[model samples]
Target chain A: AQRVTQPEKLLSVFKGAPVELKCNYSYSGSPELFWYVQYSRQRLQLLLRHISRESIKGFTADLNKGETSFHLKKPFAQEEDSAMYYCALAFTGGGNKLTFGTGTQLKVEL
Target chain B: SAVISQKPSRDICQRGTSLTIQCQVDSQVTMMFWYRQQPGQSLTLIATANQGSEATYESGFVIDKFPISRPNLTFSTLTVSNMSPEDSSIYLCSVEDQTGGDEQFFGPGTRLTVL
Candidate 1:
């Protein structure tokens, strides 16, 4: 069975500071990792994907196959970046369901 | 990428009553999925809605309790029967489009509160 693990529940940082939300997964197949973000009172949206290798809102995640990790990082955080971030893994199991990790709530203070 | 929409953005219902949530996709999709999410928690896959066929539900979920229908590639619905307080959660519908990748686009979601 495939599973996603997000070690942090809450991460607090100041505006313009660097932020990293840790994520790890357990899967034997080639994993397709993604990051989704949900702002207050808004719908959830895709932030980025490992396959795209592009950054959104200055956030990027690198899939480290050997480490079994895909950590989301932003060099300079903004107040608008405060939101709930989810790490999801899509694999060929359970009818290709996207297994999501318990999200990490980020609070960017000024 | 695909765009998805869900109706009844939120509702408060009494116990034993049922609510049906609707999902619509902008373009034809290959697979539609339903998921449950508690506040401040992760998403749990409820079922896979296949066009012209009965939905395939995951463990801990059944058709009798959560009936699903996918009449076409662009639309699906989920009905939650005999609701209880435990059923109060956000239900989301997603799609796997022919965008040349396995990325899934999600709807805004329907928030149900059973009392």
Candidate 2:
């Protein structure tokens, strides 16, 4: 079965601190990974994807095929960065449905 | 990224009633999806609302219970029929916008509460 897992349900850190949200997956074939974020009272939005190899709001994720992981990391957390973050995986064979992890609530305090 | 909108941002409904959620996109998208986000759970794809074709439901979802309609390239609707308390959750519509690898854009979501 293909599944995405976010080990931590909640993560808290002070502003300017380094932050890391771990995400792992179990799949049989090549998987495309992405990170989605939902701010308070806001819609779920795509933050970054492994394929893009680009950083957004100082966040970056790397696809580790051997480890089956795509962890999101930020060098300096901001108070405005507090939100719910989800890890998603797209199976190439299906109708392009996205499988999502349970999600992690990040709270960056001042 | 494409802008998406959903109607009835939040509603409280009685059990055994039904509610229809609407989704509209700013541009014509190739893929439209309906999702359920129950309290304390991740978003689950209920069905794929393909324009001009019957929806493709997920394993645990059915067309009879959750009827979907896609009338055009940029609009779709999902109706939750015979609702119960279990049906109370946040419903979201999404579209995949990508050149190769898929990245999804989502609506603000409709929050349904059953009593």
Candidate 3:
């Protein structure tokens, strides 16, 4: 079974501070990790994928195979960056099916 | 990326009733997925709807409880049958990007609140 764990429920940080949302996964096969974001009154959208290795909105996540972790990080937290972040894993042959983490509510304070 | 839309953005229904949510995509997509998001929780996939095949349901979800229809490549519907208070949640539909990769585009979602 593939599972994703996001340890934080809510993370509050002041503007310009660094932010890190922790995510860990348990999967026997090679994992395809991604980060999705949902802003207030907006639909959920893909933020970044491990395979792409590209940053979106200054957010980046590195997949660590040894540690089985894909943590999202940003150098400076902006007030507009406040939203719900979800870490998802897709199975190698599971046809793009995703198993998502509990999600982290990031509140960037002004 | 695909443009997706779900009908009945939000609705409040009584228990024991059924609500069918429709999802339409701008372009034909090979894979469409239905997911449920409970209050303050992450999205959990309910089933995968293919164009001409029986929908494959995830564990803990049954066909009798949540029936899905995929009559074509660009449209699908999910019906929440015999609804209860626990069935109140946001139902979402997403389509895999046709261009390639594992990226998916999501609809606004149908918010169902069972009374």
Candidate 4:
């Protein structure tokens, strides 16, 4: 079974401070991890994927295979960064099914 | 990325009634998915909807409770049957665009409140 765990349900950070949202996964094969963000009044959207090896909106996540973690981090948090963040694992199969973690609500306080 | 849209952005429904949510993609997609997010919770995948076959439901979600239809590649519908207050949730539809690397783009979810 594939599982993703997000330990924190709510994480508060001050604006201009660094922030990190933890995520860990359990999978048998090479894991494909993703970070999806849902801002207030907006639909859920993909922030980044491990396979891309790119950053979006000043956020970057390094897929640590040894740690089995893909923690989303930003050097300086902004008020606009406040949103619900979800970490997901895409299984290696035909259907392309995804197993998601319990989301972390990021509150970037001004 | 794909442009995905869902109907009835929000609805208040009475118990025992059913609501059918429709998902439309701007471009044709081979794979579509349905998910549920309860109040103060994360996303839970309900089922996988393909273009030309019966939907594949995940554990704890049955076809009788959540009947899905994917008659074509660009469109699909999910009907929540026999609703209850516990069923109040935001249901989301997502698609995998082959061109858009492994990321599943999501729709503006339908918020359903069962009373």
Per-residue lDDT of candidate 1, residues A1-107 (tens digit): 88999999999999999999999999988999999999998877789999899989899999999999999999999999999999999867444589899999999
DockQ (Cα-based) for each candidate: 0.68, 0.77, 0.82, 0.79
Tell me the tens digit of each residue's lDDT in model 4 across A59-110: 9999999999999999999999999999999986565688899999999999
Candidates 1 and 4, the one with greater lDDT: 4
Which digits, one per residue and each the tens of the lDDT, describe model 1 over residues B3-112? 88899999999999999999999899888999999876799999999888889988899999999999998999999999999999999998876574766788999999
Which predicted model would earn the best DockQ? 3
Query: What does candidate 1 score on TM?
Result: 0.94
**After aligning candidate 1 to the native by TM-score, how far in Å is the CA of B106 from where it should be?**
1.1
List candidate 1 segments past 4 Å from native: A94-96
Q: Pick the candidate with the highest lDDT.
A: 3
DockQ score, prediction 1 = 0.68
Candidate 4 clashes between residue pairs 3 or more apart in a chain or in different chains: none
| Residue range with the least summed lDDT across 10 consecutive positions in model 1 chain A | A90-99
Worst 10 residues of 4 chain B by lDDT: B96-105
Q: Tell me each candidate's i-RMS in Å.
A: 1.5, 1.3, 0.9, 1.2
Stronger candidate by TM-score (1 vs 2): 2
Give the CA lDDT, 0 to 100, for residue A41 in model 3.
90
- Residue-wise lDDT of candidate 3 within A13-84, one digit each (tens)? 999999999999999988899999999999999999999899899999999999999999999999999999
Cand. 3 Cα-lDDT: 0.94
Task: List candidate 2 segments past 4 Å from native.
Answer: A93-95, B98-101
